[model samples]
Target: MAFTLPFFSAKTLLTTTTTITQFPENPKTLILEQCKTIKDLNQIHAHVIKTGLLVNPTIAENLLESSAILLPGSMDYALAIFRSIDEPNPAAYNILIRGFTLKQSPREAVLLFKEMRENSVEPDKYTFPCILKACSRLQALKEGEEIHAQIVKFGFGTHGFVENTLIHMYANCGKVEVARRVFDDMSKRGVITWNSMFAGYTKSGNWDEVVKLFHKMQESGVVFDEVTMICVLTACGRLGDLELGEWINEYIDMNGLKGNLNLITSLVDMYAKCGRLDTARRLFDEMPRRDVVAWSAMISGCSQSGQCREALALFHEMQKVKVDPNEITMVSVLSACAVLGALETGKWVHFFIKKKKMKLTVTLGTALMDFYAKCGSIENSLEVFEQMPLKNVLSWTVLIQGLASNGEGRKALEFFSLMRGKNIEPNDVTFIGVLSACSHTGLVDDGRNFFVSMTIEFGIEPRIEHYGCMVDILGRAGMIEEAYQFIKNMPIKPNAIIWRTLLASCRVHKNIEIAEESLQHLVRLEPTHSGDYILLSNTYASLGRWEDALRVRSQMKEKGIKKTPGCSLIELDGVIHEFFAEDNSHPHLKEIYNATENMMKRIKSAGYVPNTAEARLDAEEDDKEASVSHHSEKLAIAFGLIRTSPGITIRISKNLRVCTDCHTATKMISKVFNREIVVRDRNRFHHFKEGSCSCNDFW
Candidate 1:
């Protein structure tokens, strides 16, 4: 094989190839072929400079055409070559203008057009559309009108591309009326022109016009694009029209349009907000791939529907799939924690925030503080507040509320003062927190000053909540008549809470007449709540009005309104034990009952007398004693004593306010059992020790 072939000499091969030419005769075609990419254009420019043909007139014109049309941003190199010519033709200016417009440099395009006009370069039909596109992107309405005049001057106004871009310019610049006028005046229109008008209406949020235009396009037999479908779906979402949204979904499915994540996410959110969570979940499940947005929508829907546990479960499941959580996800999860009082879980979220280095924006920080506060971690709530990089009104309000609810009223009031000192002007909610603190701590004078300052200093008009706090403060301080007078003079009508506060104070002071007046107003506002009727009955019983008490109970029965049974729960060793009135459900019920009986004996011997009158039973003395013995807090304490050793604090949370008989019994039990008992009811906390309550029998 090596000896089979003969090789030609280099001199003979060069002489043979000298007769052939490799390039085109027209340099224009050669230039166009050479200017394929930016690097190729540069190489051609170098070759042109080396050939000494750069100054040649015909070659320069051809170079301008090749560079401008072949490469984007080649206009600059082409313009340099064109300007080097002493007298460039109109075609050169047209090439530069079109290239500038194509590069989205609209301002420069307009400037080039001006330079061309000053140089007396006549524009052709192609020149008008390019310049009009530049005007549209720049939103240069006045300049666009000038271009329109030029178009009419050039007799190209009726041209399709020219007229379409004019419409786009006017519409995009918020001159839709002008756009419509142009469209109406047009002798002929294309699908691009109609689409421009439709998109203009959509951008203006004119949904009705968008729909009308869409129908008009359909009547004209114009085809729609994916952009149109997405836009209509957005409008439907804004209207919360489930019917329309479903129609659009069905249309998309029937058309077999490839479903994208954005469309699916929007549909899910719209359905969820319209109270169609099941449908939302169905749509979400049908998605081929679940993004973070899809997961967040489902989690938020669950939270909004009061399914906090389910929302939390979904959040954990999201983590298992390694879908990174964003601000929206964290906010929804934190809200779920707030509703569930999930302290440990909320803390873990906080830790995650730190590990991820997420910015604690005002809203996110407020949500975190709210979660901690609601979960009964006021200290952690305060820490979150202090560490916040930015503080809004809500941040300050949540911290103050947390402190007030945790019985740190003094600290709450102090923060309110600090807020004022910092000139963080107080709003109505700020006053609510401060007034609530005053109510909790019995600072009547401070509350009155803040209430007055609300209108006088801050110009914040007082609402019903503010009035309620004022009434509560006075009522809790044993000024029942004063609270009644305040309610009478309130500018806004007193609500159930205002009247209820008065009735509660009346019960405490044994004032039957005031209780009757408050009860009358309460029943008129909220007649369905059984607690209101029960409170009124208890007030009557405390006043020895057995007939009125019996009448109230009978009316409740006739209305099919049953009083909520009082139940208390205690947490011990990470387990919660619940007890109800007269409950014997525990396995060691016998032992618990015996232990409670013995404790009661010791309590009575220590001077604790049962106040059955507060029960409003209207029974014989023996029956009243039995009724007092079967209270839920007594049962909880009995179970606590049987289950735990002495000297440990017993914490119980009751659904309803503790009755006077149970309150007295708890104080005595604390002393007899040598334990500190903490009872949290709907209103506030009661700390009992050594046969006395921390409230000094005032609460």
Candidate 2:
């Protein structure tokens, strides 16, 4: 438990030893009752002079400062009055500077400092803090240094008031080193001094240093404030230090700092980011009131943790409470909607943005674009990108990645070129999108050259994801040997993704030897992961090696591993409906089954065969066919086709790769039913139209 600021602000540091002269039934009470406007203030100024109240320099300077405080816009009138005084004191200068700086007129305040020095009015201990704050606000580091020298020259070097502001100025101007020197040299340190240095490090994005400084503060036994905790909480969140975050929560309670809204919000944010959603929500619900930022933190955390339904529910509760959401909140909502394929709800949010006339910030626009693309509305994604007035590297990455995910691989590469042509340097993420484009479209040469150019042309050292793309590129192109060699030769060690990529390619290309080898490596790397086993088993099943497939399945049983159940989601009227393989829980089970049965009959007539070879069950052909017929995606697609109007494309989100039988059936179903079917599965998107797929049977 430590001391607490309860609240913190730069204006708190702008305090002065000088106090405003109190009037006794004078200008404020007697004559200035109608002084509502600047004009009335001018009249009052003339009257005060006519009454001979401004007798000497002392009274004149006081009046001048008072008028400035009263009419903040009447800086010109205050200056005129100040000039009329024979000699304005340092208190007069400090008072004016503090007023202007706190009112968001830092430039004018600094200019007054220059004028004060020109008139030979040397600044005192009080003057340095106010002027230094002005320089901090303006980020005028050179001027701050000049003021630092003046502080030393005026014998105010050792004053805590002056040194604290000096640290604040240096920190605000990104001079953390200089600020730390000031902090270290201070013989007498208090909570404000420590808070000032911590604030500077937080502002400069030295998060690790923030945590380190807090430990030092604890050792020093300086009672810290809410501001100090905020900095430490932020660092803990970024570093995912849940243990420290829990300790912070306990410390807050032990110290009786729970009533502070900012401190509570910071705790909520930290707990949520560290994956303690239940704890975060408890803290959030216990609050008497919530702001947009607190709501945003919770919603975004839900989205990031794959709790899309919880996220959307929180957003709905937020709306009912009338706490208006800002851009950050909307972005998180859009992300949740995207994952759930809640297209209608996402559109409503988009409309809300337009209705509020909120500018399309880069992050918000990118989120919208990603939502649309994931919902299978690629055109809407493109429109959002085009309408964005400002774009950064993140913006371009989202667009390119969206295009790639929507199966517009060629278009993604084209935009990558456009991005490079515009002098927007491609970061590591941008290259992942670009390389993925080449992999999906079977652009092997392009993928290879781009992989090399990542380091050569862009100077972006290849990451694991980039290397995985190359493995996928070669594997998908039926170059199994080269893909395996690539893995072996990787400068960085191959992760599970690379081996899995090569395994998948071996399955597709029927390279059984390499597939088994890849599975062996995966067994060592991820012995408990069910994915590699499933893929290798499927590889065997596809090639009529059921004994090998059954053996793998037995190994899974021995390890107490079960394949993840396939689940698919379809959105209708802003509501997402989920279906599992052979699901029987839906209220519309009879109708959905009937619809699925009829759709299968029609696709069978259109020459869709039951590819039971893809089935993992070691059962009779009929049982395998029965199981494959009602895979989660088919059930979800059936529901979509029955509820939606004819000719409207149906979209599905699946938690696993689309089985071979499902993919072939969907292609025929699209042609026979005269509808497009868009299914985004675990790996990529497949757009089924006219008995052909966007992947061109490669996937």
Candidate 3:
């Protein structure tokens, strides 16, 4: 080395020089490549400061740009570095504004743009799109228009991206016509521009316009994607145009989109809701993957169609498939159970929830409680309700309804008071439940107070349900005239239920004139329901107006309508047996008939006297007694006593209100057999014990 070998020394020197200048050749590019995301950018920034390169203006601007794009809140950090420069360019300002738009703080973006303008940082074509996107999100049409003028003044309106954003802004802000004008002015429009306009029309419920625009886009050869198909299907679904929906179904099939879960769900819901359940079921079965939503849709369809058994079976099948049941699924299943009076099945679901530790969401708990209550198992319902750690308005409402249905009307009132004491604000549903309790218990004053408090204290306007409950409460308490006046004073027009409540009361109190008036209102409101006509006929017969009753019956015949036959069910030893009035279809019919006849004779011996006139029968006294002997409740009760021990309680559920004869017969039978009888009818529960009813003859 000391001898200075010239070739070897020259080689060593060249290597040293190459290493020293390699980083400087592309220092800015190296810095950007290092800073990709927020964390990486911060680390690189630290490296830049440590390496004494922070003072380089080019390096500093690159850092600002990287941070603005990579990190959401890094705009401020970028701006701090940007301001340190001697003079920043429009690129720096544009980066900051775009960052703000990405953060959804569109107002801040526009403000920063203005600040940039004041600082003499002129915007380029890139700046307008970011600003216009912000305007579209904010729906600030006026601000967007001002920006549009500025874009034209700057000669950037011809930029396709800038023009498309303006179209979107106007379209999103409900200015579709203006958006169309801007789109027409565009020398060239992008696919995004067309999509924005299509979405706008769909959102505005302009289904026809949506279809026309979709066709136009297709004609222009724009390829349809998942998003476009979804929009079109949603519009068709909302319009309830089965024909259009069918067309879309065929389109999806032709396109080989059967794997799309969202599309399948939408089609299933559309078909089911449009009264095409068979088609919906076919689609649902064809799906390879069935989610909880698909199963819930099918169950809801069955429930609405009164196919309770099918709904319940589907719910069970859903569980067997291990599809996790959500709140909606629980609601549908519970509604099905309620319809079928499937108390045991409902109980199993309640147990399943606890076994699985499913979160007791408010809706799920309310639905479960409602199912148990309707199925005549209020005790179990209360157990589930009390175990809930959280209670909302619906929880209280369901419990109140359960208590009322179980003839624990006083307990229902107490629960309402407790709910108020706990400072849990009551909603319209809670008030409905409370009023229902009062009506069942004949608490006229309590019901009135709740009705007044609904408007005066809670600011909840009374709906038709509340008005109907009030009428029921007053009518049950024999205030027939007041109930009629209350219906007259309802702010909203009285619906069938409201007028029917008054008519029912008139029949109870023997107010024939009031009953007639209420009947007229009912017939006008619900002309298609044969039950309403039959009820009016019964009311006329109650007052010995046989001709008037016959006239109502004639109208029913002319309308091709018939009343639903009264039926009752009794559950014994985990088996349910059903009986219908005037029906002799049971295998044990002869025994049931003989027992019912003997029981009637014994009940008459106990001072019952076969009060068939109370049933409004248009027959001889002897014939009336014979006819009333075969009433459903009478058959159910006689069968229960024959089957069960003398001291055991007999429980029966009737599909209709307990007729006057049945009520008297139940009381008499309870005393004669020395056993308690619980009869849950359409309206309320009647506990017959020791020749007395819980309703105190008030119902």
Candidate 4:
């Protein structure tokens, strides 16, 4: 029911008319219209109450607008005055509806519109625009369609404002094609209409369509704005088209467009994502102001491009500069920590997150879980996983991968069962992790069953990675003949990595015939890869075929193929130190060498026999021992022991697989020095403690 008030009468309203005539115009109206502050509006409200001027609908509308639209968070005051009116008009309803929409409470606006309609308050052109905006914000496509029918019923189909909103509603609801049809039927087009479609395409990840429409907008000579450029820059970034991004940057500068923080951040992100870190950093430094997003873009780009250490340093710089990090920033920083296996630093980040009271969102939780898993802390990874309020496929996959890589294959499989019980469908990555767990645990039958079920039950078509995992499972189980037949019968042509996996297994089991076959396929598939030739050489060397080993090396030299030297990274005091095989480039070279010598002597005394046969060096025992002692992992571990306190865990990241000799030596060192060592090699993680490894020496 409409609320009534006896505050206004014919005689009292005459006082407002007399007052307005005496002022030669509507000065009270001007005060209500032009008042900038709530305090000024409050004084005008007092004047309205004293003069009983709200009975004049024009005066009341202005007052309601000033309260609801001009002053934010004053909706209560406007609604109080609106309800006090005996019969609020359409203008007053429109004012409140627009206020609710702008305040991001669109549902409230929809409710108010419903109330207005039920009360028989006829809507104006302004009313439809306001409510349509609410529909777009709410993504209420069904209700928006009903409103469209009403617009046609009212013969307002040709109205530009209403039609423009209809286009926006469809676009935001992921109905881009319907939006396009509406746009095509329009007799007149506005710049906002074009921008709406561009934004829609971007939301749909249709970058190619975005670029096409951008050109179309340009051809139509419709002046575009910063919003258009922002969407275009996003497309350029995702496409990794550095040339196009640079051209857009030039366009911005040439047009003298005002550089807002959003635009600048987009440019920085585009350059960073395109692998132009230097350009990104320069733009980042030159920006007059920086926000968390600008910092996150650069950090994430650095992490994704394998500059993990650099990304961590930038994250520290962000902290020192007092730019608060959001969830995205934390995700990027955690990714860097995972890459470097800097568990100490990752722990500090976790502490900071808790201290800051940041919400443990799924993305951040997954990152923390991944960091612990990669850092050889699977227990902690499981804790993070269980504590996460929400778990997506990514979260579950990380935990499974972490457990599988840490040699907890049975546990990973059990967790997969639990996930299935919860009805959480697994994706391709999850299957890869499950297959890897099967391979690690020697569950051949289970692997085969899962592979078949992946298609028959889950409808997940096996990709190349899944096939590779299956081959690895069979190969690692010592079924060389079966693995070979599996590769031969593969529906998809096995790539070089798949062939290399088979060859490595052949080397492990000393299957000469299969090794030669796998090498033949690998050589043809990747003729220029020095590693491929080196693998063949190693296979021959394992079988004591010196002549064949020499032939493989000779072919490599003839083709100018230089093997990638093994390098290892050890993080000490939050700084990463790198060492190459036999490279004495450190300032403490003499001390590091002496430490390695002492470590080797002690380990030998503890019955550690050096496996010098696998050494590529075809020299005397002493020469081979000397060469193997200075390998990258040994140097890094020696340096770590010499510099760090005793009993401290040493973490190392190796560029290539840890050699058999180095692996054995590291196991002995872990026992001798009473230190736990975690090494992340090219393939998986190895945690050595007390003369044992987490992989049980299978890796």
Best by lDDT: 2
Write one digit per residue (lDDT tens) for candidate 3, span 1-699. Answer: 011111112123212122232234335554455444565556556656767787776677678767776655677777677666667777777777887888777898888888888888788999999988988889888888889999989999888888778877888888888877887777765677777777777756777777777778788787877667667766665566788778878988998988899889878876876678898899999989999888888888777667766787888788789998877877887887776566667777777787878888877888888887887677878887987778788888889988987788899999989998999999998888889889888889989998999999999999899999999999988999888888887789988888888877877788888887887887789877766676677778777888888788778778777666779987676456889986689989999999888898898888987655433234465676777778898998999989998798787878887877788889989999999888888777788999988877655
C-alpha positional error of residue 372 in candidate 1 after TM-score superposition, expressed in Å: 2.3
Error of 3 at 558 (Å): 7.4
- How many angstroms is residue 351 displaced in model 3 relative to the true structure, after the best TM-score fit? 2.0
lDDT digits (tens) for residues 1-699 of candidate 2: 111111212233212232324333344332223334555455445645765776655556556555666655766777787776667788788878887887788999999999999989888889999999999999999999999998888889899989999999999998999999999999999999999998898889898898899999999998878888888998888788888788888999998989988989999889888888898899999998899989998998898888999999999999999999999999999999998888889999999999999889998999999999888888999999999999999989988998887789999999998998899998999999999899888899999999999899878899899999999999999999999999999999998889999998988999999999998898899888887887888889888888998889889888888778889999898788999988899999999999999988888887788977655454576687777888899999999998999999899999888887898999898899899999988888889999889877766
Question: Looking at model 1, which ten-residue stretch has the lowest summed lDDT?
Answer: 1-10
Q: State the lDDT of candidate 4 residue by residue for 354-424, as single tens digits.
A: 99999988899999999999988899899989888999889999999999998899999999999999999
Cα RMSD for predicted model 3: 9.9
Model 2 Cα RMSD, 1 decimal: 7.5
Candidate 3 overall lDDT versus native: 0.78
Ranking of models by TM-score: 4, 2, 3, 1
Least accurate 10 contiguous residues by lDDT in model 3: 1-10
* Pairs that clash in candidate 1: none
Candidate 2: 10-residue stretch with minimal lDDT:
1-10
TM-score, each model? 0.61, 0.84, 0.63, 0.85
Question: Of 3 and 4, which scores higher on TM-score?
Answer: 4
Candidate 1 local lDDT, 338-410, one digit each (tens): 7655556778889999999999999889999988776666788999999999998888998898788767789
Assess candidate 2 and give its TM-score to the true structure.
0.84
- Which ranges in model 3 have alpha carbons more than 4 Å from their true place? 1-248, 288-293, 316-327, 527-561, 569-578, 584-607, 611-626, 636-653, 670-678
Question: Could you report the Cα RMSD, in angstroms, for every candidate shown?
Answer: 11.1, 7.5, 9.9, 5.5
